[model samples]
Target: MPAAMTIDLSAIPADQRDAVAAVLRERDALKEINRRLEHLVAELNHAVHGKRSEKLSEDERQLSFEDLETAIAEVEESQDTQLSSKGKTRRPVRRNRGNLPKDLPRIEHVIEPASLECPHCQKMGGCGVMHKIGEDRTERLDIVPAQLRVIVTVRPKYACRACTDGVTQMPAPAHLIEGGLPTEGAIAHVLVSKYADHLPLHRQSQILARSGIDIHRGTLADWVGTAAFHLGPVVDRLAEHLKVSTKLFMDETTAPVLDPGRGKTKTGYLWALARDDRAWGGDDPPGVVFFYAPDRRGENAEKFLRGFDGVLQLDGYQGYNCLTRPSRKGGDPIRVAHCWAHARRKLKEVFDRDGSEIAAEGLRRIAEFYRVEANIRGTAPGQRLSARQARTVPLVAAFGEWLQEQRLRVSAKSRLGEKLAYIHRHWDGLQTFLHDGRVEIDSNSVENLIRPIALNRKNALFAGHDEGGRTWGRIASLIETAKTNVVEPFAYLKATLEAIAAGHPKSRIDELLPWNFTPSS
Candidate 1:
């Protein structure tokens, strides 16, 4: 133990000493946390830019930095949850822009009479001449020769006619890709098509070739790589921002990575951390961040969530057992709220395999819990808690009584017994929602967030390498976070790229966050 933790309570009276000792202990623990964080930051700096780290490629460094920031952000968020109280946060300032995206080129055509004579002159029995007063202009979106159109910027030079003088013209604007042909909108389109639409680069390349653009797959990959490099900071900031919430849903999925040595693909993992407070009427915008790792080790989770002490609503993955174990102070490190969907899925499997009455009754009882949840969603937290207490408490008690009764009758070695045992093992975690209505009946919120990952896996087959998986995770986090906030991914990403090209200040980085984003026309 550190000397700071060992305090002498001898000078104070017994009645007041315990309270003073408790506060001192908390203060010391916080100090220790701060020291560890500073040391961790120093180590990361050394590892990232150390003498022997020269072998890493630029793409690998980009991916690693994004993942490293995720871990840093999670630890910070966890610290915030445990140390601070909820406070009103100021929303980002909205930008005033037109509905139509600016800078698209326009072509003009006009119709005019051959002669300046009014046709009404003969009909009205009077001589009259047509004169131009004003013109009505109508604009319509038109696709030119190809689906993709080139935007040419012109700078008109002006100088004195009589005397020689230096010509003056506006300076060239910076682009997301410096000295490149693609627009920010074009790059954003490619990203949305690849990640959201799940059209792999080869197919997108083919599509572009047909459109007469002739961009190769490797070139498209380069564009994606550049976009990921710039957008990585936004994802890091997002992950850090999300961890500040009191509760979050977490889950992981397999990501296949190519292994050169084995000549076969290796298994990787993409972990998702989610926040959706709308169900309980919280004002914060919903978001999720995806993290890629080499494997699904519990240490990865611990590293990702080193300082988080908030409630985590997740599935029954044994990897999370590390969090439930007693900490140095002999108290639970984190609140592990188990998913009821997982518990019920076991019963459904047994019932599906064998027409068992026990499994049927379990499903029927769990259904009641969901039925109650459906009604209270989107209400106030207090209202949700009160309703759960009134309507669902009895249902839970009756279900518990019924479960214990069945556990005694069923054989220990039987298939039904095993399913019942699974539920019994996770009984405490399953009951977490009974006390707090802010949590859901299951971890389905995060489960829904990974649907796109599965679709992309089917389309792309596997990531090119482990670092590629990290790149995939970073880009997908922004796209998916945008969807949750009802923001269009392409426009949000385009505007984001435009800001980055214009040198958006790091201090105002939150303004680029999806929830704070205002869609461009």
Candidate 2:
């Protein structure tokens, strides 16, 4: 049996007490290093073997566009229920069909045997069955595009012959453009082209030319630019409505802009703000609004979020602190939340770099927290909070203690040290979700929302200017928020644009907003 290594502190002489403390500190540091190595190995093994880890291991992640009905149906099927009143059983689509006997009877003979006669001997010979080989077949699930029809309105005016007053009976109802070449449908097409399709004006002109439309890209661009200008009031109203929500998720990404004067491009930031609560049913399901700035200073976020109050959940961006900071006018601070995914990501990166055993263990413990939340996804916010509180709070505390101990053992310049620093720095915000039932464990839902923009940015590169980027933000906010709320973006945009053109009251624009509105069946 090993003797208990205990020193009687009371009996230690005054001169040697400091020496004893130093020895104890060194012993503890060595123990921490050994523990970290063990944790790193365990994390590597878990990463190799776990399904959840496989999800995070992708290099170039693809954003999947899931059909809303299909997703709702999936939710229904898993619970052995139906989403629709028809009560049909919902089943998941099979990825691969199981093997069937090759000799199974066919509905029709795939090959009819052809009698062969020998050319040299004139004797009937049995024909050999041959199947032609071709290239390996690749398959994709087929989808049918929705049938679209444009309604053209023609109003004929007649003079009043009986009154002899030679007055046009009635002027035709006004259109978005009176003498302009583009019809309402044409304008809708152009808007959809520029915004939803991400096709630049020049590219669209060439495409129109291929279709014999003979419209210049400048004309399309002018029309769009004019439309966006005229719709400023509507956009402003939408932004105001979105900001009124009690919670907002925000993120930013780089957007490149063309500069004709400098003969070089410049980078800008696309700042987004939204209420991203898809799991919770509310007036604010999702309300994304975007802002564009030449620089990504904290002030840019401050400008967009002015007069907005309530929780702002975000990754650990210092810029967001500007939003949550107390106003000079003596108002409440913007409530802030830090994402757990960001913390986990930092640790994951460190573990990848240093292969630290402690980092791996920390990740495993953190992953267990996410696993509990995953099981309760889409449940009531209260239920999610309760589950997390029960399962996550303890793990987080232990992880924090572990981190503090490991921080002292690792080199301050090492990757492990950086991970510890990041976690420690954001510890308060990371754990704040535990106290609020409405808060989520991570900003993943908003991250999922931002991913599409990231993909689009990769393809289109950037917006034309700050105004162009703001337009992108405005449109993306409405569209992405509409998507999150299960409202078709194009349909919503088309209807909202029409309403705005018809002089719909700016104050009542909330009727056209994404989260507050639903599609007409």
Candidate 3:
């Protein structure tokens, strides 16, 4: 072991103390640089050989700086407590494995012994009988392949016995498509398969073919178009419902559509608006609506959100910035709440690349705000507002000051500098959560709602045309919203189509929404 070196300030001359302090600062800087270099090498190695997403794995947590801070806090608290504590330490307990859902019907198969006679007295055939005993049981999951069946409707003709009366027959039931081969259930199945399961119509056509049913892909497409036409009223109502919410989360994702003459796909945008007040314990049910636009211009957002006048939570996209700007017509501008996750993501990238202390500190400060949010997560809006005012407000103020100080220290052109500038620019929007507890700190809810569209895009590659894209959005909106409401998409869509076929009134369309829908047996 090396001997410890100690410096006594009193022994040193006052003039030389300044030089000593300068040397100590240089040593600390060198140590920090070395630490960063080591971290960078490790990160590079992981990037080359490990999983793509930057999310920490179980093993990676051991080296995580955030985990380090948590461990230190735990150690400090443990040191403050007595060794023989009265309270028990909460060791993590393993939970019992859950059985299969009781809702699923079970079929049993029993295996019997080949010989009923006892082995001890087989020659004598003891007792000439076998007594009852307990039996062992096990379960195995099974699936039934898709089967196609035809429904034959026969209408009996009736004629009056009196002379020259016109023949009368029972009117046929209302079908989604008059005289069409597919039933309402079949059409609902295709829609749910394409939109919810991300299966393209072409693949569905092939699957149907395997089941000995040959329906052309073009015909399937027509069926989808018809479904969209009939579901249009429901989509309109859903959009209106989403807009009426006081707080809404908005996001957009790229959707490619085929260009007829160009022989290639043109980029389109799917704008998603979602309302989820469950986090703040509000009574409103969660729902999402999607709109497809040919372009991602500011005018499109303006047009789509024309009637919406409330807090709009979104990311750092500049197109949405126009919504908050003073319009030439002069009206109440939509209040924008910037996503803290986006801001934190920028700094996280910096940390991942260079492991800079500045980025880490920024994340640490932002994490403090989220910590406050976690404490008030499921509380009522009033309680959440009170908690935010008591805890988050002061922390945000201090973080803002620290950010300003950081901006002054870093080079303006550097990556970290650019990120700090973004934070400073959106400071007011980021602080919106401090004023209104109903607004989320990030627009992750909307982003999550857009992920299904991204998956569908990956599978279908591109929509056939702009109209097809619009149809895709309308159907996906209902399916996803049903999923959000915990309603089975197929059951909801089937019931909805049947109701529409039965001439359900447009004036009472609210009952057809996913939240209010009741599945038919």
Best-matching candidate per lDDT: 3
Off by over 4 Å in 1: 1-146, 157-167, 327-332
Per-residue lDDT of model 2, residues 1-521, tens digit only: 34538878668999999888877765555455445545555555555565445355232422221233344444444334322223645456556644444544334324433644334354345444445555454344445433344456677667776787665645555566666776555665666666666676778788767666688877887777766765566567767776777777788877788776887789888887767666654545566666788888988887787777778788988876766655512236777788989888887876776677888988998888888777877777788778878887898888889888988988878777877788888888888788776788788766776676776676677777667877777666667767777886666666766676677786676687676665565
lDDT of candidate 1?
0.84
Instruction: Please give the ranking of all candidate structures by lDDT, highest first, separated by commas.
Output: 3, 1, 2
Query: What do the candidate models score in CA lDDT, each in turn?
Result: 0.84, 0.69, 0.85
lDDT per residue for candidate 1 within 111-199, as digits (tens), equals 88787777789578877898899998766666664267789989888888888878888888999899997999999999999899989
lDDT minimum window of 10 residues, candidate 3: 79-88
**Model 3 clashes, total count:** 0
Output the TM-score of candidate 3.
0.80
Which candidate tops TM-score?
3
Question: Superposing all C-alpha atoms, what RMSD in Å does each candidate have to the true structure?
Answer: 29.4, 20.5, 16.0
For model 3, residues 1-521, the per-residue Cα lDDT tens digits are 24435677678899999888766665555455455556655665664455444665333443454554555445444433422242544434334445677778888898888878777676776655566678887766678976688999999998888776799899999999999998898999999999989999999999999888899999999899999999999999999988877988988999999999999999998999899898988888999888999999877788778788889899888888778877812235999999999999999888888988999999999999999988889888888889999999999999999999999999989999999999998989999988887988899888878888987898999999899889989999999999988999999998999999999998999999999987654
Off by over 4 Å in 2: 1-59, 63-154, 160-163, 281-283, 327-331, 516-521
Q: Evaluate model 2: give its TM-score.
A: 0.70
